[model samples]
Target: MKTEPDAFSLEDLRQRGREPWEGIRNYQARNFLRGMRIGDGVFIYHSRVAAPGIVGTAEVVTTAYPDPTQFDPQSKYYDAASSLARPRWDLVDVAYRHTLAKPFPLERLRALPEFADSPLVRKGNRLSIVPITANQWDRVLQPAR
Candidate 1:
């Protein structure tokens, strides 16, 4: 999942150990969070920085649940349309796994053969939670292997 480093960095997850990944307002991104299963691996990407890249990894520790932020008027992510019975947003808790020894820069990943068809590498694609193919996953972890 992608986040602005200033808002939430890989270090933040490491310090907290685990966190509820909330505030997902996009329908497509919300669906991806809902589809996550316990123990599933996730790449932690730092976006909107000088050097955007995958900084670390995390593990899904909880299945999908309604994001409380969507119902809280105090929250910036709050949606008035969302209700207790029919929530419009969902989130999953993820635990820190490891920080990559060397972060995978977006520029490098875009040039790789494995990511040729990945939405992550496509120009103008802005989906925060993207599905990575098995091959692409392996390639991303190859350096750490």
Candidate 2:
């Protein structure tokens, strides 16, 4: 889940094997976690920098739960509005498999006319977790021939 502390390179993501994705505080992210199912594949991507891109693949291993950070009042992610009966944050586990030797750069995806309407490659889109179509995944992963 934590591909990297500073920069999430393909190499870093490749090393995170079956780690639980946690510390998500955003409402949308929490909702995604709440709706997650086992074995759901994630296109582990890099963020928080200029050269962000899809680094590798990870499969969801566990279901959703209240983020421990939310319970701790001292935590920055803590929710004063949330209650014990209803936790505010949720997350899933993502098990790393392998990294693409040559990861399809984010720039490439943005340049494709086919991905003109794609949310992941869209300009100014910053959702950490996103869905990937099988065709899109195949296209992005196509090895040089």
Name the top lDDT candidate. Answer: 1
For candidate 2, the TM-score is 0.81
Model 1, global lDDT:
0.90
Task: Please provide, for model 2 over 1-145, each residue's C-alpha lDDT reduced to its tens digit, 9 standing for 90 to 100.
Answer: 3244374454554575565565676676677777878987777777665676777777888898777777888977678887779877787777777677866668887886756777777777756666667777677777866
Q: Which residue pairs clash in candidate 2? A: 18-95
Q: Could you give candidate 1's per-residue lDDT for residues 1-145 as a string of tens digits?
A: 9999899999999999999998888899988888888988899999999999888899999999999999999999999998999988999999999999999999989889988887887889789998766787778888654
TM-scores for all predictions: 0.95, 0.81
Top candidate on TM-score is: 1
Alpha carbon deviation, residue 70, candidate 1 (Å): 0.6
C-alpha lDDT score of every prediction, in listed order: 0.90, 0.69
Model 2 spans with C-alpha error above 4 angstroms: 1-16
Indicate the worst ten consecutive residues by lDDT in candidate 1: 136-145
